[model samples]
Each structure stands twice: as C-alpha cells, then as structure tokens.
Target: MADENGETRRQRNERFEFISPELQVPDGITHVWDWFWQLSGRRHSGPEALTFADVGEWSRLLGIEVLPEEVQMLMAMDDQYLRAVREDQRAARERAQQQ
Candidate 1:
C-alpha cells in the first residue's frame, strides 16, 4: 500500500539500495554504500566511474560536509575496492541473517 507520501514500500526500499549490515564500514561513512549506489548507474562500473563532482553532489544530498582530505580519498577509491566493500557488507548481512 502507498503511504501518505504515495510511496509504496518497494519504492521506499528502492530509494536506498544499500543493504545495511552489522559490519562497520571503513572511513566511518555510514551512508557510503547508499551514496555509491546512488552515484553509479550500474554496479559493474565500480566507484572509479564516479567523479569528484559526484561525491560533492552526494555530500550535498547527505547534508554532510566533506573535507578536502575526505574528498580526495573518496575520489581515489577504484571500482574494485568499492565492489569488494559492497560484497563484504552483503556477505556479513547474509551471515547475520542466518544466525
């Protein structure tokens, strides 16, 4: 059923693709996974596909201030690393669900 905002549960779920896990994400960017999915058009392209401008826009959406150091670090992260992080996070979630 749609809510007051006319958003179905599935629609709301699709808004943030990240499947949160018990594992702690590196860099303490709690929403990094969500931001990653939002910024990238497909999972295959990886985070390297994202640009510094994309990070800036993501930060704006998150309403968080990004320091120059953090921006540099984020921009430097390649798709392989991001994909690994995402895989690890999902695996952890699956493990937790089984327990």
Candidate 2:
C-alpha cells in the first residue's frame, strides 16, 4: 500500500533486489543468519549495484538521463553497470596507490 508520501513498500523492495539464487527464508533465526551470510558472500549481483558516477555514465551511455533512483530500479539485471562501477573503483584505488 502506498502512503500519502507516494512511496510504496514494493518500490523499496525493488531497491534491495539482488541477482541471488532462489532463497527461502527459513523458520529459525540461526538458519536465517546463515542464509544471510551466504547471500552476502555471493560473488554475483546485478547492475543496480552501480556506483553513482557509473550510473551517471550509464545514463549518458544509454542516451537517457534517467534519474539515479529510477536507474537503480531499471538496471535490476544490468551486469555491465556493475562492471563499470567495479572498474571505476579499481581505477580509483590504483590512482590512490600511485600518489
């Protein structure tokens, strides 16, 4: 249900979406914690994880200045954006190391 502020719970769920294998929240906190750790340790994720700058570049690359929040939802399956963000981070680290 949408609140008076116009934000829906489902919309927020979209933001946390990940490219994880099917997961079922089990009935116990211990098992849930284990599952949570496993999921966090997963090497795979979607492009929605793109950095803010990379997201801007993605908008330029896509010929659409879509808002960051919107892109965050749209790139739910975007591996390219994820790669771009990672590369950007690596470059920044290398530059820092050089200095």
Candidate 3:
C-alpha cells in the first residue's frame, strides 16, 4: 500500500541511502555496509576485479579501515545475493530520482 508520501511501503523499505562520497567510513555504518557500497559503485563504474584483496585495497585507498571480521562477512555473500542487493538498490535509486 502507498504511504502518505505516495510511495509504497515496499519501496521505502527497499530504499538504500547512498552514503556521501566524502565520508569514507560514515558513522553508524558497519564495515560490511561500507564494503558493499563501494563494491556496488565499482560495479557500476566499470568491470573490475572482485576479490577480498581488492576490497582491502579499496578500503585503504579510501582511508577507511575495515576489521577482519567485517571483511569476512562481506566476502561471505555469494554472487546471487550481491546481485539481488544491487538490483534492489538500483530500483530504489530510480524511484528516489522520480520524486
């Protein structure tokens, strides 16, 4: 059902707020979230290596530090899950743009 804002609850729930580029490690965001956001942006930018090492290097380049446990969890997500997340984020972004 649509909310008062005319956006469906599902759409609101599916929305993934894009973190500002300036904040390398935004407050209240987990390491996995940061990693996923970077990965998603990279996937959009162009074809690139998708490896744990690459993630680590990216974090370093961004001046963000990710714990080992966080890296492990990020790497644990299989391709299917990652793709689903990317699609959902993209859809939410499109919806937001329309508003």
Candidate 4:
C-alpha cells in the first residue's frame, strides 16, 4: 500500500479471491451487512465505541464465513482495516458541483 505498488496489491487481492462458489452467500445477510457497514462508515464522527476486534470476535464466534467478501470484511474489521475501497459515491457528487 506504499505508493503505486502493483505486485503487493495483486497478492493481497488474491487472498480474498480464493473462496469457492460454495462460500458465496445470498441476499439474506444484507440486514446484518448494513449494520456493520453503517458502523464502519461513521468511525470519524460517531461515538467511537467498540474496537474492530470486538466486531471480528463476534463474527468469528458465530462461525460464519459464507462469502469471500465476508471473509475479507471480518478479517479487516479485526484491525480497523475496512474501507480499503475508495468509494467514489459521495466524491462523485462533490465533483459534479464544480462542473
């Protein structure tokens, strides 16, 4: 992640891609997903409670790694490493204001 490191990035990407079709989950987990999503998204302005270790441990105790994304997500949540994605959502809206 230090500068434009392509080789390092590729290997990191491969770890999460190794999950098989059986590991993929359906839409049922969306409710829980949304809850975690909202919590991580508000890290800066929110109450600043519950470390990522807490969330990851809870997910682990439940013994569910049904999706590749879920595996990557829970792993990252253990270390506050979520938001690896640079979502252009709000950024896209802000850029349009200048145009």
Best by lDDT: 3
Every candidate's CA RMSD: 10.9, 18.5, 10.0, 12.9
Per-candidate TM-scores read: 0.36, 0.26, 0.42, 0.27
Candidate 3 lDDT by residue in tens digits, 1-99: 244467744566567453423536556655576567567566533323368777777888989787787776666643545565567568768979999
Error of 1 at 56 (Å): 1.0
lDDT of 2 by residue, 22-82 (tens): 5464464343244223333333443234344654654476565454455444344244435
Best by TM-score: 3
Candidate 2 residue pairs that clash: none
- How displaced is residue 41 in candidate 3, in Å? 1.8
Give the alpha carbon lDDT tens digit for every residue of 1-99 in model 4.
Answer: 221334333354466585333334448766455646554654563234446564565557766444557555544553453243233234435767979
Model 1 residue 17 CA deviation (Å) reads 30
Candidate 4: worst-modelled 10 consecutive residues by lDDT:
1-10
Select the stronger candidate by lDDT from 1 and 2. 1
Task: Evaluate model 4: give its lDDT.
Answer: 0.49
Looking at model 2, residue 24 earns an lDDT score of 60
* lDDT at residue 60 of model 1 (Cα atoms): 91
User: Which pairs, if any, clash in model 1?
Assistant: none
Kindly give the stretch of ten consecutive residues in candidate 1 with the minimal lDDT sum. 39-48
Which residue window of length 10 is worst by lDDT in model 2?
31-40
Model 1 misses residue 55 by how many Å? 0.7
* Model 3 regions more than 4 Å off: 1-31, 44-49, 78-99
1-99 in candidate 1: lDDT tens per residue? 344467644565578684434546666765554455455643344334666767777679779787786665555544555676566558657968999
